[model samples]
Target: MTGLRVLITNITLAGRTGTEIVVRDLALGLARAGDRPMVYAPRSGPIADALRRAGIPVVNDIAAVPATPDVIHGHHVIQTAVALARYPQVPAVFVCHDREAWHDTPPRLPGVRAWATVSDSFRTRVAADTGLAPEAVQLVLNGVDTDRFQPGPALPPRPRRALAFAKNQGHLDGIRTACARRDISLDVVGAAVGRIVDAPEALLPAYDLVFASALTAIESLACLRAVVVCDGRGLAGMADLPTYEALRHGNFGVGTFTGPVTAGAVGAAIDRYDPVMAVAVGQRLRAEAGLTAWTDRWRAVYAGILASPAGPEDSEARNLALAVHLQTWDPAVAPSSWTAERASLIRTLARLGSGLEPLDPGVSVAATDGDRLALTGFHTPEAWGVWSAQPTCSLRFRPATAFGPGRIRLRLAPFLPAGSPDARLTVTLNGQPLGELSFPGADGAEPRDVWFAVDALDGVTDAWLGFHSTPCRSPVSLGLSADGRRLGFSLIEVAIEPD
Candidate 1:
């Protein structure tokens, strides 16, 4: 993987935004991994100097036209993220650091093919706006350099690290209250950090108890302090460094960083953790989640893009012409409407050129006998939990309408109690699951694709789909139309088939 080149775009090196941290960590990690990781950002300040000082080369120019060095990436560079689309022939990936970025404007340029986001929550948001599947959006959590961090100095705080944060967050306030009812000084090292607001800069580093909002936590670790975090939040791979290290060494004057923040939880952390012996934990994480390790992750992405199909805008236009020559094409997925009829699909496919393949034959279907295809039937109580409404079938029926076998020349209708991947149904035939042509979903409040399939089933009498139901989730409704106003099956030239 050595010598693989990657150009990170749209970052200003000097500021302390998460974008900077990501670039710094990425460069540092890449260096450790023996990579040629180049960062492109506005040339200025300590950030640029710092990157250079750290041996990371900086390419400063906002409008710099990027050539194929291997891969071209724009991160934290909104609006321009989709600029990758301009290089339609090039396999480019856009990185989004902000969650609500797409709300105001499209995050992608019709040119870009792939996207990456920092959090799953944020990834989902982007996928919805881009009309891309969630998988099209990759989840690469921010990482940390465990090597540059260690358990914080034992500057005799009025209390210990774990105890301090527990107390500072007022975990003891409950004890203080219960004391009126008979309890005192209880420690809950792990507590929930719901919505976060920035704390005073000067006060953050020296705060008595340190419950991290991920960003600050990893930074605190670099400064040698133990960090307490919510169960799920933290640096992607290396987040567990603090707790694991403290427990491993038995010497940091600390213990595990965990939650369910309770007296028992705190006591357990303290009981088996050895801060001194914990050094191994940090060392191991450095090997596993460190910069070098993550650089490898980026390398694969670069390689995949380099090997992918793409063209310039002019070339894309030519491709459309070629596709039209073939009379088959797919335009950028447009909302289903009379304006976007079967004729529109044919034109869109022309834009796609002959290089792109149709979704899948198995998932494509049209209603032949009627508007509804009783693909399969099932029921759930009004209340259900995280259950997959996704059903698979092995049956096939003649198309009331069709483009080609399994080709959705026209969208009969599409509905989801939820939507998209969450749309609940993905087509599988004769036990084979279709890729890019699949569906899996569950019930939720908002509109989503909870049932769908990339292709239509060809043959079989019986079929089964994976399903789940729980108390916390909802009244399950299946989608049946393109506008998604009705609950029924997509009337394609088929019926539910089984594997």
Candidate 2:
């Protein structure tokens, strides 16, 4: 397979997300294995920069590729379609990473010689979706760069420090509570927590145990850290010698997460941690899940496809598949030429189709109000409130009665970790600045009644309330608590009252 030109396509190279990381490792590994590998992504960012620094060419435009590739290693469906359409003669092996994601749907194209999935779950999904034989979908489990994630210092008798490494921050409160009960210091790093570690290989060594799923769990095991197969979906318990093969077959992903995430569940997972057993698991992973071996598997797939290529589909069939792929197009990832008007129209149509209704006036609504009140930039609601996960959060609703001068009251609590500054919020109504509200650092978690006068509501039937707060900081960074979520403030309740 040496000297084969491989064109790898992905949706974005913006961040170290799951698929992006896979593409990054695959390209680097293929290049090191003597293949001429180039990457094509719709958008470029840090991951793209890293690939370029490693001497692998990355292009956003399909036309920019210097020459046609011998084989196409396609990822997301949209970008894969672009590559396949551009290089009609090239045979492609499409890899499906997610079972539920629209973009991960296997392409029904004739030029696609093969299909690969990262787990047994995804393999089953791809096979079912494409109506192919189960054996036809290859299972290509994700691999870690074992050299980069070498075993760290010996673990203590018990885990003194732990990490919750997942992009989906589901049921984190339970994990935090579990870690607190055991007196184990916990930190979090993931997109949901506003912390994206570019080199998790460097970060995994510091923790004796890691609460993660999929690739992160594998990487942590390679670092000799006891791993609990858990993520936003749920808890999957500890990955020890006995369960490693089963978990590995499922890619240590959602399929393994059979139990709900709770303090008891997480605590039980922690109880299963064994330092000696953890090192044994790491040794096994290093032997079997190395990037080099993984790359070789892919090379074999490409070679096999090249040896017996599938015939190209008829023009009508190809056009129908392309049309189906276009249905999954997201304006957020689309080119700058995607007009705002078009995006707005799509959203409007979606909302209308969804049958969304406005919140009732004079009724105080809480964070758990769900779809009754439109909320954005807020995390999943807890029993008491919801944390604003971003720098700004907003609420949209239609006034039940005719508009008049009024005041909006918000019961909120600032997320002031120890030694951090107080949170200041700039309020906005219908896109116009209303006023500001400041909460002292001492008022942590204690809901305070903050009211702001809004005269602009006089003529508005629909109202948009925005809260722009200071930058949110994670408690792990401040050494205040084990919670890794970057929080600005918590919204407990909101109401609008006539002046």
Candidate 3:
């Protein structure tokens, strides 16, 4: 696999998710293994920040990738489709990291050379669903950076501190009960805790036992912590050799055919937890699921994909692939009903007015040249709309389409000015006041959706959707000197929905 130019695409590079970690590790590992791995993502967050800090190249545009990469590997279906469409001559592979990646079947694209799943259970199911030969979809377990998540010190015999580093809300009560029964102090973390902790690798070593599953479980095992695989679904007890082997094939038995997480099962796992046992499990995982081992498997897969013949081109297959991408966002884009007539007049429109052509005829976008901000490095297809301070350059959109009872949803990039009061956006429908939306003063790229009901739009064939914000200082004036634009809001997406 020497000199292989591998282009890896993921939907987002936000940290706190296992997918981000896998992609980050894969890039770094591949680089270390003497291969060129470039990452393409729509958005940047913790993982992207880390990658940049480590000198790993991350690109936002697929066009920016070399004209002839040796392989295209993607984590999400839409990304795979984009790659296949843009690089029709390249060999591609889609990694099924979650149930949804292949739930509707792999993108029916001609360029996709193979599929890889994080677990064997998914490998088999996806192969069956996509009708690919069993060997075409292989199992590539998620790996932890053993060097970073290496074992802490030996745990005390009577460990009282426990942590639940998972996001499964369904298993929280059981985890609490089990920890209480075992007289251990439990600190719940992850998305279930209302926030995603940014430093999972640093946090795991502080606990004696952890309730997690999937990559978290593997990472905890590497940190020499006794892991109870209760990922919101059910309990798959600590990784004693038997349980480790059984759980390994099923994502630690979290969402894969495991019974519900029960207090008894969790409590029993807690009672059975031993420092010596935890050490043994961690040692085993460090060798088997380490970063080196995982990347080696991917390296071989890339080599195999490149060595194979290109998939035969089929026009129907390309359309099917596009349908898979569209269906992920809306089932209304079903292959049977995607006749262009019933399709949402507006689908995946990036902004009110941008250089890109309109996705629907019913929508009209017009803006002053200065108001259009090119958010070219992100997931959006069009440059985003920056609220212009100038009166005639504000963000406004008019949809010339009849509608039933429904509402319009605007997805804005979460942006809050530093040291400023909360900003309120007054939305209007057809020259009448709909309501106001507020955004807290914070800074992040997470999407915030604001919906305004348009009950008055029932019989109307056209209406104006307007966003007005209180006049504010420009980013540069406010001391964010790098950004000179006096923008009110960055509009990422807007769509109408039936009430």
Best by lDDT: 2
| Model 3 lDDT-worst window of ten | 371-380
For 378-446, candidate 3 gives per-residue lDDT tens digits of 111224443322211123333344454677777764355565656666665534577976666665536
| Residues 1-499 of candidate 1: C-alpha lDDT, one tens digit per residue | 5765566665466555556666777877767776666667654466667778987777675345334445666675432442343334445577766543321222434445567765544444466556666567776655565554434444332323332222124234322243223222223333232322322232333432344444455444444433434222101112244445332221111111212233333333333334433334434544545555566677677767666666545766645644442232224444322234555457645733221222233333322211112222211111221111123212322232222223222222333445433333344332344423222453333323323343543332222221222122334445433321223334333232222
TM-score of 2: 0.66
Give per-residue lDDT, candidate 1, residue 258: 18
Q: Which segments of model 2 are wrong by more than 4 Å?
A: 312-499
- CA-RMSD of model 1: 17.9
lDDT of each: 0.41, 0.77, 0.65
lDDT of 2 by residue, 1-499 (tens): 5999999999899877788888888999999999989999989998899889999999999999977899999998778889988987789999999755667877777779899998765664576567775568898888988888888899999999999975765558779999999999999888889887988888889898899988888888989889988876556689899988878977887655544566777898899889999999889998998999999999999999999946644788877766765654555555322344465446656755332344445334453354445555555555676776556567666665655577878887777766665556888775567888766665345778888787735434346677787533432221122343456777877777776
Superposition TM-score, candidate 3 onto the true structure:
0.63
Q: Which runs in model 3 stand beyond 4 Å of their true positions? A: 101-105, 253-257, 311-331, 335-499
Cα RMSD of all models vs. native, in order, equals 17.9, 16.9, 20.7
Each model's TM-score, in the order given?
Answer: 0.46, 0.66, 0.63
